[model samples]
Target: MRADAARNVDAVLRTGARLLAEDPAAGMGAIAAEAGVDRRTVYRRFPSREALLAAVFQAKLDSAQRVLDEARLVEAPVAVALHRYVEGIVPVSRDWPVDVRRMMRADPAASVRREEQSGRLDRFVQRAADEGLLRADVPVAWARATLDHLVDTAAHGFPLIDPPQAADLVVDILLNGVGRR
Candidate 1:
Protein backbone atom coordinates (compact mmCIF):
# COMPACT_ATOMS: atom_id res chain seq x y z
CA MET A 1 0.00 0.00 0.00
CA ARG A 2 0.94 3.66 -0.17
CA ALA A 3 2.71 5.34 2.74
CA ASP A 4 -0.45 7.23 3.74
CA ALA A 5 -2.49 4.02 3.58
CA ALA A 6 -0.06 2.28 5.89
CA ARG A 7 -0.27 5.18 8.27
CA ASN A 8 -4.05 5.04 8.23
CA VAL A 9 -4.00 1.34 8.98
CA ASP A 10 -1.69 1.86 11.94
CA ALA A 11 -3.77 4.78 13.16
CA VAL A 12 -7.07 2.90 13.11
CA LEU A 13 -5.42 -0.04 14.82
CA ARG A 14 -4.16 2.20 17.60
CA THR A 15 -7.45 4.00 18.16
CA GLY A 16 -9.73 1.01 17.78
CA ALA A 17 -7.54 -0.95 20.12
CA ARG A 18 -7.79 1.62 22.91
CA LEU A 19 -11.41 2.86 22.98
CA LEU A 20 -12.70 -0.62 22.23
CA ALA A 21 -10.77 -2.15 25.10
CA GLU A 22 -11.75 0.58 27.53
CA ASP A 23 -15.34 0.37 26.36
CA PRO A 24 -16.74 -2.21 23.98
CA ALA A 25 -19.42 0.23 22.84
CA ALA A 26 -16.86 2.53 21.23
CA GLY A 27 -17.61 3.38 17.62
CA MET A 28 -15.55 3.62 14.43
CA GLY A 29 -15.96 7.39 14.29
CA ALA A 30 -14.26 7.77 17.66
CA ILE A 31 -11.49 5.48 16.52
CA ALA A 32 -11.12 7.58 13.39
CA ALA A 33 -10.86 10.74 15.41
CA GLU A 34 -8.17 9.18 17.55
CA ALA A 35 -6.40 8.18 14.38
CA GLY A 36 -6.74 11.72 12.98
CA VAL A 37 -8.47 10.33 9.97
CA ASP A 38 -11.92 10.48 8.39
CA ARG A 39 -14.72 7.93 8.19
CA ARG A 40 -13.87 7.28 4.54
CA THR A 41 -10.33 6.37 5.48
CA VAL A 42 -11.46 4.08 8.28
CA TYR A 43 -13.98 2.37 6.08
CA ARG A 44 -11.52 2.07 3.23
CA ARG A 45 -9.16 0.12 5.41
CA PHE A 46 -11.60 -1.84 7.61
CA PRO A 47 -14.73 -1.98 5.36
CA SER A 48 -17.08 -2.51 8.33
CA ARG A 49 -17.21 -2.26 12.10
CA GLU A 50 -16.54 -5.97 12.27
CA ALA A 51 -13.61 -5.66 9.89
CA LEU A 52 -12.04 -2.85 11.87
CA LEU A 53 -12.52 -4.85 15.05
CA ALA A 54 -10.87 -7.85 13.40
CA ALA A 55 -7.72 -5.96 12.60
CA VAL A 56 -7.75 -4.50 16.08
CA PHE A 57 -8.37 -7.94 17.56
CA GLN A 58 -5.60 -9.57 15.54
CA ALA A 59 -3.20 -6.87 16.64
CA LYS A 60 -4.06 -7.48 20.29
CA LEU A 61 -3.73 -11.25 20.04
CA ASP A 62 -0.40 -10.93 18.26
CA SER A 63 0.86 -8.58 20.94
CA ALA A 64 -0.25 -10.81 23.82
CA GLN A 65 1.47 -13.70 22.11
CA ARG A 66 4.63 -11.65 21.92
CA VAL A 67 4.37 -10.83 25.62
CA LEU A 68 3.84 -14.50 26.29
CA ASP A 69 6.95 -15.16 24.27
CA GLU A 70 9.11 -12.52 25.98
CA ALA A 71 7.98 -13.48 29.48
CA ARG A 72 9.33 -16.89 28.65
CA LEU A 73 6.30 -18.80 29.97
CA VAL A 74 8.26 -21.96 29.13
CA GLU A 75 10.81 -21.12 31.79
CA ALA A 76 8.62 -21.79 34.84
CA PRO A 77 6.17 -24.35 36.13
CA VAL A 78 3.43 -24.30 33.55
CA ALA A 79 0.66 -23.75 36.11
CA VAL A 80 2.34 -20.88 37.86
CA ALA A 81 3.32 -19.24 34.62
CA LEU A 82 -0.09 -19.63 32.98
CA HIS A 83 -1.92 -18.29 36.05
CA ARG A 84 0.29 -15.24 36.19
CA TYR A 85 -0.10 -14.80 32.45
CA VAL A 86 -3.87 -14.84 32.67
CA GLU A 87 -3.79 -12.47 35.61
CA GLY A 88 -1.61 -10.17 33.59
CA ILE A 89 -4.48 -9.90 31.18
CA VAL A 90 -6.44 -7.88 33.73
CA PRO A 91 -3.89 -5.27 34.83
CA VAL A 92 -2.31 -5.53 31.45
CA SER A 93 -5.35 -3.79 30.01
CA ARG A 94 -4.16 -0.64 28.28
CA ASP A 95 -3.98 -0.19 24.47
CA TRP A 96 -4.47 -2.05 21.21
CA PRO A 97 -3.07 -5.36 22.31
CA VAL A 98 -5.54 -5.39 25.13
CA ASP A 99 -8.28 -4.52 22.67
CA VAL A 100 -7.37 -7.62 20.68
CA ARG A 101 -8.82 -9.83 23.39
CA ARG A 102 -11.76 -7.55 23.91
CA MET A 103 -12.62 -6.87 20.29
CA MET A 104 -12.12 -10.43 19.15
CA ARG A 105 -15.08 -11.38 21.29
CA ALA A 106 -17.35 -9.55 18.84
CA ASP A 107 -15.20 -9.60 15.75
CA PRO A 108 -15.90 -12.28 13.15
CA ALA A 109 -12.58 -14.04 13.63
CA ALA A 110 -13.19 -14.49 17.34
CA SER A 111 -13.44 -18.26 17.17
CA VAL A 112 -10.19 -18.42 15.28
CA ARG A 113 -8.48 -16.38 17.95
CA ARG A 114 -10.19 -18.45 20.63
CA GLU A 115 -8.95 -21.63 19.04
CA GLU A 116 -5.44 -20.27 18.80
CA GLN A 117 -5.29 -19.24 22.43
CA SER A 118 -7.09 -22.39 23.42
CA GLY A 119 -4.42 -24.53 21.80
CA ARG A 120 -1.56 -22.65 23.37
CA LEU A 121 -3.11 -22.45 26.83
CA ASP A 122 -4.09 -26.10 26.66
CA ARG A 123 -0.51 -27.05 26.02
CA PHE A 124 0.45 -25.16 29.11
CA VAL A 125 -2.23 -26.92 31.17
CA GLN A 126 -1.18 -30.29 29.82
CA ARG A 127 2.33 -29.50 30.89
CA ALA A 128 1.07 -28.54 34.33
CA ALA A 129 -0.78 -31.84 34.60
CA ASP A 130 2.28 -33.67 33.48
CA GLU A 131 4.14 -32.03 36.35
CA GLY A 132 1.47 -33.29 38.79
CA LEU A 133 0.30 -29.83 39.80
CA LEU A 134 -3.01 -29.95 37.93
CA ARG A 135 -5.73 -32.59 37.79
CA ALA A 136 -4.95 -35.24 35.23
CA ASP A 137 -8.43 -35.11 33.79
CA VAL A 138 -8.51 -31.36 33.45
CA PRO A 139 -9.13 -30.55 29.83
CA VAL A 140 -6.59 -28.14 28.44
CA ALA A 141 -9.13 -26.43 26.18
CA TRP A 142 -11.43 -25.89 29.14
CA ALA A 143 -8.62 -24.30 31.07
CA ARG A 144 -7.87 -22.02 28.12
CA ALA A 145 -11.53 -21.05 27.73
CA THR A 146 -11.80 -20.38 31.43
CA LEU A 147 -8.85 -18.06 31.33
CA ASP A 148 -10.26 -16.24 28.31
CA HIS A 149 -13.63 -15.84 29.96
CA LEU A 150 -12.07 -14.62 33.19
CA VAL A 151 -9.71 -12.13 31.61
CA ASP A 152 -12.40 -10.53 29.44
CA THR A 153 -14.90 -10.49 32.29
CA ALA A 154 -12.42 -8.92 34.65
CA ALA A 155 -11.42 -6.46 31.99
CA HIS A 156 -14.92 -5.24 31.13
CA GLY A 157 -17.39 -5.99 33.94
CA PHE A 158 -15.47 -6.06 37.22
CA PRO A 159 -17.91 -5.65 40.12
CA LEU A 160 -16.05 -3.42 42.55
CA ILE A 161 -15.55 0.30 42.21
CA ASP A 162 -11.87 -0.60 42.09
CA PRO A 163 -10.98 -2.52 38.93
CA PRO A 164 -7.95 -4.13 40.52
CA GLN A 165 -9.97 -5.77 43.27
CA ALA A 166 -12.41 -7.12 40.74
CA ALA A 167 -9.50 -8.56 38.81
CA ASP A 168 -8.30 -10.19 41.99
CA LEU A 169 -11.66 -11.81 42.37
CA VAL A 170 -11.29 -13.34 38.94
CA VAL A 171 -7.74 -14.51 39.48
CA ASP A 172 -8.55 -16.03 42.85
CA ILE A 173 -11.50 -17.90 41.47
CA LEU A 174 -9.47 -19.22 38.56
CA LEU A 175 -6.59 -20.28 40.76
CA ASN A 176 -8.95 -22.05 43.11
CA GLY A 177 -10.86 -23.71 40.30
CA VAL A 178 -7.72 -25.21 38.83
CA GLY A 179 -5.68 -25.58 41.99
CA ARG A 180 -4.57 -29.14 42.78
CA ARG A 181 -6.25 -30.51 45.89
Candidate 2:
Protein backbone atom coordinates (compact mmCIF):
# COMPACT_ATOMS: atom_id res chain seq x y z
CA MET A 1 0.00 0.00 0.00
CA ARG A 2 1.09 3.59 -0.60
CA ALA A 3 1.94 5.85 2.35
CA ASP A 4 -1.35 7.75 2.15
CA ALA A 5 -3.32 4.55 1.77
CA ALA A 6 -1.62 3.06 4.83
CA ARG A 7 -2.41 6.20 6.79
CA ASN A 8 -6.04 5.99 5.77
CA VAL A 9 -6.19 2.36 6.85
CA ASP A 10 -4.66 3.22 10.21
CA ALA A 11 -7.13 6.04 10.68
CA VAL A 12 -10.04 3.79 9.86
CA LEU A 13 -8.85 1.10 12.24
CA ARG A 14 -8.29 3.59 15.04
CA THR A 15 -11.69 5.16 14.52
CA GLY A 16 -13.28 1.75 14.27
CA ALA A 17 -11.74 0.68 17.56
CA ARG A 18 -12.94 3.76 19.41
CA LEU A 19 -16.38 3.58 17.87
CA LEU A 20 -16.74 -0.14 18.47
CA ALA A 21 -15.68 0.30 22.07
CA GLU A 22 -18.47 2.83 22.47
CA ASP A 23 -20.91 0.77 20.41
CA PRO A 24 -20.16 -2.71 19.17
CA ALA A 25 -22.75 -2.33 16.49
CA ALA A 26 -21.01 0.66 14.89
CA GLY A 27 -21.15 0.49 11.10
CA MET A 28 -18.43 0.86 8.52
CA GLY A 29 -20.07 4.03 7.18
CA ALA A 30 -19.72 5.63 10.62
CA ILE A 31 -16.12 4.41 10.91
CA ALA A 32 -15.32 5.82 7.48
CA ALA A 33 -17.00 9.11 8.23
CA GLU A 34 -15.23 9.38 11.58
CA ALA A 35 -11.96 8.46 9.90
CA GLY A 36 -12.53 10.97 7.09
CA VAL A 37 -12.32 8.19 4.55
CA ASP A 38 -14.90 7.34 1.92
CA ARG A 39 -17.28 4.47 2.68
CA ARG A 40 -15.98 2.70 -0.45
CA THR A 41 -12.48 2.81 0.98
CA VAL A 42 -13.59 1.12 4.18
CA TYR A 43 -15.48 -1.49 2.23
CA ARG A 44 -12.48 -2.13 0.04
CA ARG A 45 -10.27 -2.65 3.07
CA PHE A 46 -12.79 -4.51 5.21
CA PRO A 47 -15.43 -6.46 3.40
CA SER A 48 -17.77 -6.52 6.38
CA ARG A 49 -18.27 -5.13 9.87
CA GLU A 50 -16.94 -8.36 11.37
CA ALA A 51 -13.76 -8.00 9.35
CA LEU A 52 -13.28 -4.43 10.53
CA LEU A 53 -13.96 -5.38 14.13
CA ALA A 54 -11.52 -8.27 13.88
CA ALA A 55 -8.88 -5.89 12.62
CA VAL A 56 -9.64 -3.47 15.43
CA PHE A 57 -9.50 -6.23 18.03
CA GLN A 58 -6.24 -7.56 16.63
CA ALA A 59 -4.78 -4.06 16.57
CA LYS A 60 -5.73 -3.56 20.20
CA LEU A 61 -4.15 -6.86 21.21
CA ASP A 62 -1.00 -6.07 19.27
CA SER A 63 -0.79 -2.69 20.99
CA ALA A 64 -1.29 -4.19 24.45
CA GLN A 65 1.33 -6.83 23.73
CA ARG A 66 3.74 -4.10 22.72
CA VAL A 67 3.09 -2.33 26.02
CA LEU A 68 3.70 -5.56 27.92
CA ASP A 69 6.95 -6.12 26.06
CA GLU A 70 8.05 -2.57 26.83
CA ALA A 71 7.29 -3.14 30.49
CA ARG A 72 10.10 -5.75 30.56
CA LEU A 73 8.10 -7.82 32.98
CA VAL A 74 10.63 -10.64 32.85
CA GLU A 75 13.61 -8.40 33.62
CA ALA A 76 12.33 -6.40 36.58
CA PRO A 77 11.68 -7.57 40.11
CA VAL A 78 8.23 -9.14 40.27
CA ALA A 79 6.80 -6.34 42.42
CA VAL A 80 8.19 -3.64 40.18
CA ALA A 81 7.25 -5.55 37.06
CA LEU A 82 3.69 -5.98 38.24
CA HIS A 83 3.30 -2.25 38.74
CA ARG A 84 4.90 -1.42 35.39
CA TYR A 85 2.78 -3.93 33.54
CA VAL A 86 -0.41 -2.67 35.10
CA GLU A 87 0.51 0.95 34.42
CA GLY A 88 1.30 0.19 30.81
CA ILE A 89 -1.83 -1.84 30.17
CA VAL A 90 -4.45 0.35 31.85
CA PRO A 91 -4.74 2.80 28.97
CA VAL A 92 -4.77 0.11 26.32
CA SER A 93 -7.55 -1.73 28.09
CA ARG A 94 -9.47 1.47 28.72
CA ASP A 95 -9.39 2.60 25.11
CA TRP A 96 -9.96 -0.72 23.39
CA PRO A 97 -12.42 -2.58 25.62
CA VAL A 98 -13.02 -5.19 22.92
CA ASP A 99 -15.28 -8.09 23.73
CA VAL A 100 -12.58 -10.55 24.75
CA ARG A 101 -14.77 -13.64 24.50
CA ARG A 102 -15.91 -12.78 21.00
CA MET A 103 -12.41 -11.81 19.93
CA MET A 104 -11.01 -15.13 21.12
CA ARG A 105 -13.66 -17.02 19.23
CA ALA A 106 -13.37 -14.93 16.10
CA ASP A 107 -9.62 -14.49 15.86
CA PRO A 108 -7.23 -17.37 16.31
CA ALA A 109 -4.14 -15.22 16.08
CA ALA A 110 -5.40 -13.02 18.90
CA SER A 111 -6.14 -16.07 21.00
CA VAL A 112 -2.59 -17.30 20.47
CA ARG A 113 -1.12 -13.95 21.40
CA ARG A 114 -3.29 -13.82 24.50
CA GLU A 115 -2.13 -17.29 25.55
CA GLU A 116 1.49 -16.28 25.05
CA GLN A 117 0.95 -13.25 27.30
CA SER A 118 -0.82 -15.43 29.85
CA GLY A 119 2.15 -17.77 29.91
CA ARG A 120 4.50 -14.86 30.44
CA LEU A 121 2.35 -13.62 33.31
CA ASP A 122 2.27 -17.10 34.82
CA ARG A 123 6.05 -17.13 34.79
CA PHE A 124 6.14 -13.76 36.53
CA VAL A 125 3.81 -15.02 39.22
CA GLN A 126 5.92 -18.13 39.67
CA ARG A 127 9.02 -16.01 40.09
CA ALA A 128 7.27 -13.88 42.66
CA ALA A 129 6.17 -16.95 44.54
CA ASP A 130 9.72 -18.31 44.45
CA GLU A 131 11.03 -15.03 45.86
CA GLY A 132 8.57 -15.31 48.75
CA LEU A 133 6.62 -12.26 47.63
CA LEU A 134 3.47 -14.36 47.66
CA ARG A 135 2.20 -16.54 50.52
CA ALA A 136 3.70 -20.01 50.76
CA ASP A 137 0.26 -21.59 51.00
CA VAL A 138 -0.99 -20.00 47.82
CA PRO A 139 -0.62 -22.19 44.76
CA VAL A 140 1.14 -20.59 41.80
CA ALA A 141 -1.98 -21.04 39.66
CA TRP A 142 -4.10 -19.33 42.30
CA ALA A 143 -1.66 -16.47 42.58
CA ARG A 144 -1.59 -16.09 38.81
CA ALA A 145 -5.38 -16.10 38.65
CA THR A 146 -5.58 -13.55 41.46
CA LEU A 147 -3.08 -11.27 39.79
CA ASP A 148 -4.97 -11.45 36.48
CA HIS A 149 -8.22 -10.65 38.25
CA LEU A 150 -6.70 -7.71 40.11
CA VAL A 151 -5.17 -6.22 36.96
CA ASP A 152 -8.37 -6.70 34.94
CA THR A 153 -10.42 -5.09 37.70
CA ALA A 154 -8.02 -2.19 37.96
CA ALA A 155 -8.05 -1.72 34.18
CA HIS A 156 -11.85 -1.71 34.06
CA GLY A 157 -12.66 0.14 37.28
CA PHE A 158 -9.89 2.66 37.90
CA PRO A 159 -9.89 4.68 34.68
CA LEU A 160 -10.29 7.92 36.70
CA ILE A 161 -7.10 7.27 38.68
CA ASP A 162 -3.72 8.32 37.39
CA PRO A 163 -1.99 5.37 35.74
CA PRO A 164 0.82 5.20 38.25
CA GLN A 165 -1.55 5.59 41.19
CA ALA A 166 -3.85 2.93 39.76
CA ALA A 167 -0.89 0.58 39.46
CA ASP A 168 0.09 1.33 43.06
CA LEU A 169 -3.44 0.74 44.28
CA VAL A 170 -3.69 -2.55 42.43
CA VAL A 171 -0.36 -3.80 43.75
CA ASP A 172 -1.25 -2.71 47.28
CA ILE A 173 -4.61 -4.40 47.15
CA LEU A 174 -3.15 -7.58 45.72
CA LEU A 175 -0.36 -7.75 48.26
CA ASN A 176 -2.19 -6.52 51.37
CA GLY A 177 -5.87 -7.20 50.72
CA VAL A 178 -8.64 -4.80 51.81
CA GLY A 179 -8.89 -5.64 55.54
CA ARG A 180 -7.71 -3.02 58.04
CA ARG A 181 -5.58 -5.60 59.88
Candidate 3:
Protein backbone atom coordinates (compact mmCIF):
# COMPACT_ATOMS: atom_id res chain seq x y z
CA MET A 1 0.00 0.00 0.00
CA ARG A 2 1.03 3.60 -0.65
CA ALA A 3 2.09 5.80 2.26
CA ASP A 4 -0.92 8.10 1.93
CA ALA A 5 -3.33 5.22 1.79
CA ALA A 6 -1.81 3.64 4.88
CA ARG A 7 -2.16 6.93 6.72
CA ASN A 8 -5.76 7.21 5.62
CA VAL A 9 -6.49 3.67 6.79
CA ASP A 10 -4.84 4.33 10.14
CA ALA A 11 -6.85 7.50 10.55
CA VAL A 12 -10.08 5.76 9.69
CA LEU A 13 -9.39 2.83 12.05
CA ARG A 14 -8.54 5.18 14.90
CA THR A 15 -11.60 7.30 14.30
CA GLY A 16 -13.72 4.22 14.01
CA ALA A 17 -12.39 2.91 17.32
CA ARG A 18 -13.19 6.19 19.03
CA LEU A 19 -16.63 6.66 17.54
CA LEU A 20 -17.64 3.06 17.91
CA ALA A 21 -16.53 3.13 21.51
CA GLU A 22 -18.81 6.08 22.11
CA ASP A 23 -21.67 4.53 20.19
CA PRO A 24 -21.58 1.10 18.66
CA ALA A 25 -24.20 2.13 16.11
CA ALA A 26 -21.95 4.84 14.68
CA GLY A 27 -22.20 5.00 10.89
CA MET A 28 -19.47 4.65 8.28
CA GLY A 29 -20.03 8.19 7.01
CA ALA A 30 -19.63 9.60 10.52
CA ILE A 31 -16.40 7.68 10.98
CA ALA A 32 -15.13 8.93 7.60
CA ALA A 33 -15.97 12.50 8.56
CA GLU A 34 -14.28 12.21 11.93
CA ALA A 35 -11.24 10.59 10.35
CA GLY A 36 -11.05 13.39 7.74
CA VAL A 37 -10.96 10.82 5.00
CA ASP A 38 -13.25 10.61 2.03
CA ARG A 39 -16.25 8.32 2.54
CA ARG A 40 -15.34 6.47 -0.62
CA THR A 41 -11.89 5.79 0.74
CA VAL A 42 -13.27 4.15 3.87
CA TYR A 43 -15.78 2.23 1.82
CA ARG A 44 -13.13 1.13 -0.59
CA ARG A 45 -11.01 -0.15 2.22
CA PHE A 46 -13.63 -1.72 4.51
CA PRO A 47 -16.54 -2.50 2.19
CA SER A 48 -18.88 -2.57 5.23
CA ARG A 49 -19.28 -1.46 8.82
CA GLU A 50 -18.58 -4.94 10.17
CA ALA A 51 -15.41 -5.10 8.10
CA LEU A 52 -14.25 -1.79 9.53
CA LEU A 53 -15.01 -2.89 13.08
CA ALA A 54 -13.14 -6.15 12.56
CA ALA A 55 -10.14 -4.21 11.33
CA VAL A 56 -10.20 -1.97 14.40
CA PHE A 57 -10.31 -5.03 16.70
CA GLN A 58 -7.44 -6.53 14.74
CA ALA A 59 -5.46 -3.33 15.22
CA LYS A 60 -6.05 -3.50 18.97
CA LEU A 61 -4.94 -7.13 19.02
CA ASP A 62 -1.84 -6.25 17.04
CA SER A 63 -0.99 -3.51 19.53
CA ALA A 64 -1.56 -5.98 22.37
CA GLN A 65 0.81 -8.50 20.78
CA ARG A 66 3.50 -5.83 20.60
CA VAL A 67 2.92 -4.92 24.23
CA LEU A 68 3.18 -8.57 25.29
CA ASP A 69 6.47 -8.91 23.40
CA GLU A 70 7.86 -5.75 24.98
CA ALA A 71 6.74 -6.82 28.44
CA ARG A 72 8.96 -9.92 28.26
CA LEU A 73 6.57 -11.81 30.49
CA VAL A 74 8.63 -14.98 30.53
CA GLU A 75 11.97 -13.34 31.47
CA ALA A 76 11.02 -10.31 33.53
CA PRO A 77 10.16 -10.50 37.18
CA VAL A 78 6.43 -10.96 37.60
CA ALA A 79 5.88 -7.54 39.15
CA VAL A 80 7.88 -5.73 36.50
CA ALA A 81 6.23 -7.64 33.68
CA LEU A 82 2.80 -6.90 35.12
CA HIS A 83 3.55 -3.18 35.26
CA ARG A 84 4.94 -3.13 31.75
CA TYR A 85 1.95 -5.00 30.39
CA VAL A 86 -0.57 -2.74 32.13
CA GLU A 87 1.22 0.44 31.08
CA GLY A 88 1.35 -0.67 27.48
CA ILE A 89 -2.22 -1.96 27.44
CA VAL A 90 -3.91 0.99 29.10
CA PRO A 91 -3.33 3.25 26.11
CA VAL A 92 -4.25 0.47 23.73
CA SER A 93 -7.54 -0.09 25.55
CA ARG A 94 -8.17 3.65 25.44
CA ASP A 95 -7.27 4.09 21.78
CA TRP A 96 -9.03 1.02 20.50
CA PRO A 97 -12.03 0.90 22.75
CA VAL A 98 -13.99 -1.61 20.76
CA ASP A 99 -14.17 -4.89 22.68
CA VAL A 100 -12.72 -7.86 20.87
CA ARG A 101 -15.41 -10.08 22.39
CA ARG A 102 -17.96 -8.14 20.39
CA MET A 103 -16.05 -8.85 17.21
CA MET A 104 -15.58 -12.57 17.81
CA ARG A 105 -18.58 -13.69 15.82
CA ALA A 106 -17.82 -11.31 13.01
CA ASP A 107 -14.16 -12.27 12.79
CA PRO A 108 -13.01 -15.75 13.72
CA ALA A 109 -9.36 -14.82 13.17
CA ALA A 110 -9.65 -12.08 15.76
CA SER A 111 -11.23 -14.54 18.18
CA VAL A 112 -8.29 -16.87 17.73
CA ARG A 113 -5.85 -14.05 18.37
CA ARG A 114 -7.75 -13.03 21.49
CA GLU A 115 -7.64 -16.58 22.80
CA GLU A 116 -3.89 -16.68 22.25
CA GLN A 117 -3.46 -13.42 24.10
CA SER A 118 -5.60 -14.67 26.97
CA GLY A 119 -3.54 -17.82 27.18
CA ARG A 120 -0.38 -15.77 27.54
CA LEU A 121 -1.96 -13.71 30.29
CA ASP A 122 -3.11 -16.82 32.11
CA ARG A 123 0.38 -18.25 31.96
CA PHE A 124 1.80 -15.02 33.33
CA VAL A 125 -0.67 -15.12 36.19
CA GLN A 126 0.42 -18.69 36.93
CA ARG A 127 4.01 -17.57 36.89
CA ALA A 128 3.20 -14.88 39.43
CA ALA A 129 1.77 -17.49 41.73
CA ASP A 130 4.78 -19.74 41.23
CA GLU A 131 7.08 -16.81 42.02
CA GLY A 132 5.20 -16.09 45.27
CA LEU A 133 3.90 -12.75 44.02
CA LEU A 134 0.36 -14.11 44.12
CA ARG A 135 -1.02 -16.57 46.64
CA ALA A 136 -0.81 -20.18 45.55
CA ASP A 137 -3.99 -20.87 47.51
CA VAL A 138 -6.00 -18.67 45.18
CA PRO A 139 -7.24 -20.08 41.91
CA VAL A 140 -5.07 -18.96 39.02
CA ALA A 141 -8.17 -18.28 36.97
CA TRP A 142 -9.48 -15.97 39.67
CA ALA A 143 -6.25 -14.05 39.78
CA ARG A 144 -6.21 -13.75 36.04
CA ALA A 145 -9.79 -12.51 36.03
CA THR A 146 -9.03 -10.02 38.76
CA LEU A 147 -6.03 -8.75 36.85
CA ASP A 148 -8.12 -8.31 33.74
CA HIS A 149 -10.70 -6.33 35.65
CA LEU A 150 -8.06 -4.21 37.30
CA VAL A 151 -6.51 -3.31 33.98
CA ASP A 152 -9.93 -2.42 32.58
CA THR A 153 -10.62 -0.24 35.58
CA ALA A 154 -7.27 1.45 35.20
CA ALA A 155 -7.83 2.07 31.52
CA HIS A 156 -11.45 3.25 31.68
CA GLY A 157 -12.06 4.31 35.26
CA PHE A 158 -9.15 6.74 35.26
CA PRO A 159 -8.73 7.75 31.68
CA LEU A 160 -7.41 11.19 32.57
CA ILE A 161 -4.11 9.92 34.00
CA ASP A 162 -1.22 8.78 31.83
CA PRO A 163 -1.11 5.01 31.36
CA PRO A 164 2.22 4.51 33.12
CA GLN A 165 0.89 6.40 36.13
CA ALA A 166 -2.29 4.39 36.05
CA ALA A 167 -0.18 1.28 35.78
CA ASP A 168 1.49 2.01 39.13
CA LEU A 169 -1.86 2.37 40.80
CA VAL A 170 -3.07 -0.80 39.14
CA VAL A 171 -0.04 -2.82 40.19
CA ASP A 172 -0.27 -1.52 43.75
CA ILE A 173 -3.93 -2.35 43.98
CA LEU A 174 -3.34 -5.76 42.47
CA LEU A 175 -0.63 -6.56 44.99
CA ASN A 176 -2.27 -4.97 48.00
CA GLY A 177 -5.85 -4.84 49.11
CA VAL A 178 -7.79 -1.57 49.50
CA GLY A 179 -8.54 -2.32 53.15
CA ARG A 180 -6.48 -0.92 55.99
CA ARG A 181 -3.00 -2.42 56.22
Highest TM-score among the candidates is held by which one?
3
lDDT of 1 by residue, 15-121 (tens): 88777766777888888888899988898778887787777677667766765664456687654565557555554454544434355467656658656765666
**Window of ten residues with lowest summed lDDT in model 2:** 150-159
Q: Write the per-residue lDDT of candidate 3 for residues 1-181, one digit (tens) a residue.
A: 9999999999999999999988999999999999999999999999999989988988999999999999999999888999999999999999898876787777899999999998999999888888788766789898888888988888889889998898898888777756797
lDDT of each: 0.66, 0.83, 0.91
TM-scores across all candidates? 0.59, 0.85, 0.95
Q: What is model 1's C-alpha RMSD?
A: 5.4
For candidate 3, the lDDT comes to 0.91
Candidate 2, residues 1-181: lDDT per residue as tens digits? 9999999999998888788877978888998999999999999999999889888888888887888887788788777888888888888877777767778888898888888877888888888888888888879998778777777787776667878988898788777777898
Model 3 lDDT at residue 131: 78
**Displacement of the residue 90 alpha carbon in candidate 3, Å:** 0.3
Greater lDDT among 2 and 3 belongs to 3
Give the TM-score (vs. native) of candidate 1. 0.59
Model 1 stretches astray by more than 4 angstroms: 1-11, 17-30, 34-36, 40-51, 91-114, 136-141, 159-172, 177-181
